[model samples]
Target chain A: MSSNLILLVSLLAGLLLGFFTKPAANRARLANRLLMATILVLIFMMGARLGLMPDLGERILAYGRAAIVITISALIFSIIAVRILVWLFMRKRGGEL
Target chain B: MMLLAIISCLLLGLGAAYIGLMPPEVAVFVNEAPFYCLCAMLFIVGYGMGQDKNTLRGLFKENAFVFLVPVGTIIGTLVGGLLAGLILPLGIRESMAVAGGFGWYTYSAVYLAEMHSADLGAIAFLSNVSREMLAIILIPAVVRFFGAYPAVSICGATSMDVTLPLLAHYAGSKIGAAAFLHGAVLSFVTPLLLPLLIGF
Candidate 1:
């Protein structure tokens, strides 16, 4: 099977399990523990990759610029969009103030 | 399920990165950053679901007007992005920046950088990721302090995922559902608009 197919199957299986599990027990906690373990392993692998970088300074600069522009734009857009949305919808709903 | 999803994504990302199908850096990002993020997100989502399953049902029934909120958010986001492009001193790459702002920040930045030789891939990544993060943090505040509409607007493309829960939590599930719908509708629209506005 293709990796995509395998991934999809896994996802479906997980969803089914999550769906069937009663919310009362510590099932969620168990799932969280599993997720945490996965994350730690992934993080270690990522750090290894980062350590392979030859020029950390240049990479940081490049990534930094990208990060700054994206961050600012995202922040500005989010704030403004939320505000405008509230203004238009709230009034229509006859919301006070 | 969420854990499995994260693992699957990690594996896919790792394979893609290792195979040189995508930038190694991106693979690293997928591995390092999203693991913690997704873990926290999954736990929170599960906890929230456990705590408020009943409240969610009740809220949906109570506030039908909440449906209008997400519509406002989408419109607001589009306008905000356009305005940012116009006002910001982003130079020739402003369109790319706008595309990033529209929420395909990683793809937008990387594509534009490669095409234009602008080397702004990091900026694109940060811009888009920041939008997602900001939406996560601000959606609830925006909903409670301003209103649901504004909160959704601020979320941009993240309304479907990161901001959806917060919207449901604060604005009511009806509004959250509306936000998801609005986000879905906007996702397709964003791809088309990103290219037009950013020239990529």
Candidate 2:
């Protein structure tokens, strides 16, 4: 299945469970702890993936110039676009949100 | 504390793997591990959504604005990268394709590798990875100054997973559904548009 599909299914399952359970405070806190543990494993795996990739040093040396420029530019412009779009959206809605 | 754990785990994982301390089976496990973790994360995300009707209501009322987030991200990312391209040796389309990853490095980098060259692929990988890191670090500041919507957009595809916890913490539950939808739409469109853009 697509990663997207997996995401939706998992989310739906969680929703059903959450809605049905009406989790108590302790249960909710436990869920948060579990989520944190999951997040740590995920981050570690991401790092492992990065570590396993080939030619990191060479690639960085070669692409470092363009990578830095493109990364920064993409962040700036995407933020700008979202800002402008949200601004226009709020204006159309008739006030600040 | 959460951020510290994330960064440290990442560093620790990198160190162990780089030093060949991670067992070979552990390498195989890594491939499958994150996918499952992602599923759990999304599940919790959904649970949070279900737990709050107000948040869902807010997302529904802002449906039009929700539509705009991805639109802005696409236009903004492309325009930003294209402008940045002026200084680099890459073609305009190449720049767009690279930034088009929206912090999804693996697929875009692989696609660019096949469509263009390994060099462009490497660039895509590096830039997208850097983009994710930057978004993760700056999201709180972005939300504080610019508002949550833009902060979410800065996360791009990562809003769905890696950077998601940040979105929830800083943006509050009201912004949850919208950010998830925004990330989902971008994640869907990226693979389709990126290759097409590279061809153009």
Candidate 3:
């Protein structure tokens, strides 16, 4: 089948399944379980196709430097922002330090 | 349910690996990890929605402070991105800034990797994902030990998804509502601001 056709069918199926499933505990659990199962199967298939395992270590090493820089910068920025905002708010409201 | 979500994600990773063995044409959707990850996210969202109507209703209120947190976070993200761009090497700066803003490396990392190259993309992914995981684990203690505004800021871009729920669960429910609103708005704004600031 064509990509468009597949997409259309999947979309319809998803909607139909979603609509038919009542939001009760038993039904929701069943739906979640099915979805989880499908996700697992899909992931395994994708990994096999891509040969993810062998390249994993190399990918990590290659990307390590850049990742560290980004993570540290983002973390520091977030922390400072939170601190300054809290300080300003506290001062405005005359709250304790 | 949260445990179920984690298991589902793991299952998804395994499934993606299995699907990888198939011919590309035969497994279009499953071949794309991001697309499948998104599907997982959507299901998680739906499941959360299914469980609680009150979640939506509680989002709005007088004491919520919805506007304040976003304003603070966005300002923080933009300034932070600008600083990172200036100081960090040029290669992965834009992706990093964007990840910093939204706190989800997966989307930006994948996009940057595909558009630019794998090296930068992987960096973005790892960094952003780390930020998200850290926020999830730390935000509650930060809030309880410090206060709401600080927790909101500390979690920064990740406040919406990972931290918002954590805050709601641990902090007062009212604070959680405010955090959710702040986080959601920031998620949208971060992408727009990233390019302008970081030149991505």
Candidate 4:
């Protein structure tokens, strides 16, 4: 009954169903819209919960700093690694592909 | 547009709660809604993955270089997390857990909230969301300057869905399959990686 367990179960179920059904374009579109709505609701709920916390301002400031730092580092490192890989692997192919 | 909507929704919820508009009865629903909503979102994500037979099949047969994009992303993001740990106040494991989300913010945040503290979960959420925002801004520039691989890899798990169109537009349609496969691979790894990092 854990959240992760719930997530895994739901994902597996959907994967199996979609794999078998191979839903048509219309149904797939509907699912995408539904997914967007669900994500928005989840984000809203997350925000509301955080908003209800006592030290919201201070926590956001502290967490926001970490968020920005981690994001930049992740981007920098990813670009470096991928750049090296591309040069090693794709340079022979030539052109900006 | 999607990012705009996401931020707007978050702000609206924050504003709603800040203004004391949430009554006691509604607060009960707000407390529990994320669980169900997250389940739904993951289900849809899985379904999309299942539907994309080409991306999965291509993973096995495509030029091995395409696979390297996600590999680079995983390596770089975790290393960045480790480095951030050294400087920031957070421990290595916690910093890695936050980075390990790999841009799948909803699942990581919710999982950490349940397993650790809500504060850590919030940090994960903000960090991953910020990564997505950064990806949106950087994708075009990265494609123009760095190359398609970095541009696609920079998107983390969002390359397939949220940023696919942009990737296609900027990086060109030739790179679309590689980009989708890159995102799909990262998305698959995130759920497995986060729990191990947090639980350890």
Candidate 5:
């Protein structure tokens, strides 16, 4: 099966399971534990996979200047854009400044 | 919680690889296992969303204003990228391809490498990696100063995965769902935009 289909099926299965389960505090706690465990494993695996890639030290050193500039700029612009939207939203609501 | 775990594991794995502790066969598993793990994570995300009525309701109840997060993020990243490009020796197309990763470094870097230069690919990888690290550190500050939506938007594609749990925790399920949506949209476009923009 296709990866997309696999992703969709997994999501749908989870949704169905969640929909049917009773919303007890214990159940929520279990789910939280399960989520945390899965995330830990997933991230660990992600790190391992990333580690298999080419020399990161050289990559960082080679591209550090461009990378830093680009990343910081993208971050700044994204924040500024959201800040502007928030201001516009507040203005529409006649929020007290 | 996540920072310590993620950083430790990442360093441990890299250290292990560097020291030649792991076998070559481990490389095969490393390539495929992450994909399965990602699917499981997505499933968990779906389950959480399914259980949360408020998240579902917020997703459906949104109007045109709701689009601001995704739209603003894309415009902001591209604008920032274009401006940042002015400083680089690289062309605008190359810069966009690098920034277009939107924090999904592996896919965009590989794609760019195949379609463009190894240098551009390396730049894309480093750019996206730095973006993720910065986003993790910045999300809380963004939440405190700007608000939840802004916090989520700045992280881009990472909002769907690496940053999702944090977003859900600090920002609540409502913003988590929005961040997921925003990330999904960006993730879908990163590949398309990288090549298309570069072609121009």
Candidate 6:
């Protein structure tokens, strides 16, 4: 199966299981802890993979710069758009200021 | 602290690889590890969402219009991605795909790596991680100054989890609820968007 399909399937399976089982709070917390550890391991593996890439230094530098640029732009634009939404919302509510 | 730990983990792995600490036999496992991790993470996230029972249902019920915030976030972030694409070396689609991550770094990184270039995937990871870190830092100030919507908007998908408490404490429970709704919607949609956009 495709990766995305795998993701969706796993997610739906988990959702169904959790919904039916209604695991205790402690179990949920343990699940969360396990998730965090898994995430860290994933990141570590990503780093290792990147490290093994050719021209590792240059790639990191370039990717880092692009990352910063993309992040800042996304943040600014999302804020602006939401601000407009807020303004429109207030106006639609008959200017309840 | 979580951010620091994530970074530390990344660095540690990089350092380990840099020094050839892992045997060649282990490289295969390390390479395949992210896919499993992504699946595990998604399952856990889905389970959490299932357990909550409120976020998806609440979106349609109370304050239904709050859904617009996420709409705004999606459009604005895509626009930003387009502009960034123009400014940067990446293609417009590539840039938008990266932006479509919406601060969910883990999935974005792994998905992009498998579907697209590993480099692009790495960029998605770094960019989304930075986005989350920036949101965490800016949220309180944004709430106090710009108001609640902007504060929540800054968090992207993370408003549902990583930054929800901060939004609640600073912006109040009402905005907190909106933030959760915003995040839940975004989280559901981002995976769909990333693949569609990155196809180019």
> Which residue pairs collide in model 5, if any?
none
Q: Which runs in model 2 stand beyond 4 Å of their true positions?
A: A1-59, A92-97, B1-62
Q: Compared with the real two-chain complex, what DockQ does model 4 have?
A: 0.66
Q: How well does candidate 1 match the true structure, expressed as C-alpha RMSD?
A: 9.1
Could you list the iRMS of every candidate?
Answer: 8.4, 5.3, 6.9, 1.9, 5.1, 2.0
Give me the runs in candidate 6 sitting further than 4 Å from their true place: A92-97, B55-60
Q: Estimate the Cα RMSD of every predicted model relative to the unseen true structure.
A: 9.1, 6.2, 6.7, 2.2, 5.9, 2.1
Q: In order, what DockQ does each candidate have?
A: 0.20, 0.44, 0.24, 0.66, 0.39, 0.65
Number of the predicted model whose TM-score against the real structure is largest: 6
Tell me, by DockQ, which candidate is best.
Answer: 4
Total clashes, candidate 3?
A: 30
lDDT of 1 by residue, A1-97 (tens): 2422333344344444444555655765665576556544443343334334456457656555645544555455555655554555566755522
Task: Point out the higher-scoring one by lDDT: 1 or 5.
Answer: 5
Model 2 native-contact share: 0.68
Model 5 lDDT tens row, B1-200: 55566457657766676666768898667555655665666566556656665554666666445567778888888888999898888887788678878887755654554456556766776788788888888878778777787788778888977898887777776676677778866865664576577762
For model 3 chain B, the run of ten residues with the poorest summed lDDT: B41-50
Please, what are the lDDT tens digits per residue for candidate 4 over residues B125-158? 8999988888988888998899888998888998
> Lowest-lDDT window of 10 residues in candidate 4 chain B?
B106-115
Model 2, residue B125: C-alpha shift (Å): 0.8
**Alpha carbon lDDT at A67, candidate 5:** 83
- Candidate with the larger TM-score of 1 and 6: 6
Model 2 C-alpha lDDT per residue in residues A1-97, reported as the tens digit of each score: 2554555678688877877776477877778788788767776765665566676567557587888788888888888888888777687764224
Predicted complex 6: CAPRI docking category: medium
Residue-level lDDT for B151 in candidate 1: 66
- TM-score of every candidate relative to the true structure: 0.51, 0.63, 0.61, 0.91, 0.63, 0.92
Residue A30 CA displacement from its true place in model 2, Å: 22
Instruction: State residue B64's C-alpha deviation in candidate 3, in Å.
Output: 6.8
Candidate 5 chain B lowest-lDDT run of ten: B106-115
State the number of backbone clashes in model 1: 12
